[model samples]
Target: MSLEIAISIVMTLVIAATPILLAGLGELVAEKSGVLNLGVEGMMLVGAVAGFITASLTGFTPAGYAVAALAGLCASLLFGVLALTIGANQVATGLALTIFGTGLSSLAGAGFVGTTITRLPALFPQGLAGHPIFRIVFGYDVIVYLSVALTLAAAWFLNHTRPGLILRCVGESDASAHAIGYPVTVIRYLAVAFGGALAGLAGAYYSLAVTPMWADRITAGRGWIALALVVFSSWRPWRLLLGAYIFGAVMTLELYSKAAGFALLPPEMLAMLPYLATVVALAVIAMRPSRGRLDAPRCLGKTFRAGA
Candidate 1:
């Protein structure tokens, strides 16, 4: 590819990766804090719908994102309550949360079908006026910049902050944290809520800056991929960022390859790139027989009773 083509490809990857990066980062925080939130996909759906509806009504993209994030936070908070406070099964509650989110989204967005909104504008000014490299690196709507910032912030917070230390403590051993007066349940609750907000923001980015339209299955399976990426990244924020972009590049290349007359690969294979990458990564991780065991929280998915 020529320099211009290369720049274009990189730009496409950056655009494609923005949403996944957001979701993956959120999942990273949730998991690192010692909670297995299986409802990320559901949270994304709720965000998409909530953002779409609010944006359509208010004609303001920021307001849409705000409501969407709140909606996602509320949805994920419910799941945290079930899995942490009530001591429900994490897997079951997560599955139920997905179902509930899907149904609620459908009901909420039924009237907004076939609608479209003028998405939020790109943030880069003269920097991207005609500079291909600069545009590729800095050009994009507000969501993309925010997502990237969040990634850096998350990485820094997780690796170098007191709250992050407490979070990691809760994830590694809630009992230990509680004994040290860490308020394990509260920490987990907030972590899950933050995760939800990010997930929602990711979904809103899709609706407001990507598709900019309301539709069912809008999120497709991006949520699952984000979940997979968290595991593939070993719950590291920066690794999660890298993995998400790779997945995003694969997704974009799949489409471009098919459209660009590259008949070298099967159409089906291209279509399966996202899910296939997840499986391949998981397999690679699984094959490392000598790899150290994961340091999952002692009571990560278990309910925390106050005095039980």
Candidate 2:
């Protein structure tokens, strides 16, 4: 491949990875605070529809993104209430939220099935972005850059800040955190809300930035992929970024194979490549002797009661 082709492939990889990176980072924060939200896919779907609808009506992309985040937050908050406050089973609650999000997004997006919107505005000037060398770095929309920034920020916050330390404490030992005067429940709620918002924004990026159109199930299991990325990264923000790109590269290969009509593989096998890679990667990690149980948050998927 020529330099331009290589750059184009890299750029496409970045775009493909952005949503997963964003969602995985958000989920990392929530998991660090001891919450396992399986409804990220649901939140993303709602965000996709909400963002698409708002953008279509208002003719403003940012407004659609804001509304999408809000929609996701709302869906996640419901999970927080049941799992955090009511002390419901976290896994079941997350599954139910996903189901609800699927139905609700489909219903809301029905009118938008055939609709398309203008792409979100880019941050850099077209002249600069179009330059061959410059385009490699500057051609992407703002969300792509924002996803990288968020990953770095999450790594910093988790490792350097006092609040980050406290959040980790809550995840490590909620009872101990409570004994030390930190409000475990409150921290978890906030973390979950942040995760939901990110998931929503990821969804919005699909309709508003990637495809610039509305469709049912637009995310197409990316939310689940995001969840897998969290595990694949061992819950580290930087690792999550790496894992997202790796997965994205596989997805990009699938796209290229289909578009080029590569006869070496059947269409069905090409479609399964990304998912197959995910399973293989996870299995490899699981097989590592160094990957102990302690790698994950101690309280992950466990609901905490304030008084208990």
Maximum-lDDT candidate: 2
Residue 224 error, candidate 1, Å: 0.5
Model 1 local distance difference test score: 0.82
Off by over 4 Å in 2: 257-279, 286-291
Question: Per-residue CA lDDT of candidate 1, range 1-308, in tens?
Answer: 57787677877888778888898888788887778888888898899999999999999889999999999999998998788888898889988988888888888889988989987766867657357667776667788888878989988898899888888988887777888888988888898999899888888877777888888878888888888888777777777788888987887776666677776568787767767776777777667789645434455566666666
Model 2: lDDT of residue 145: 87
Residue pairs clashing, model 1: none
Alpha carbon lDDT of residue 11, candidate 2? 83
- Which ranges in model 1 have alpha carbons more than 4 Å from their true place? 126-130, 286-290, 294-299, 306-308
The collision pairs in model 2 are none
The number of the candidate with the highest TM-score is: 2
> What value of lDDT does candidate 2 attain over all alpha carbons?
0.88
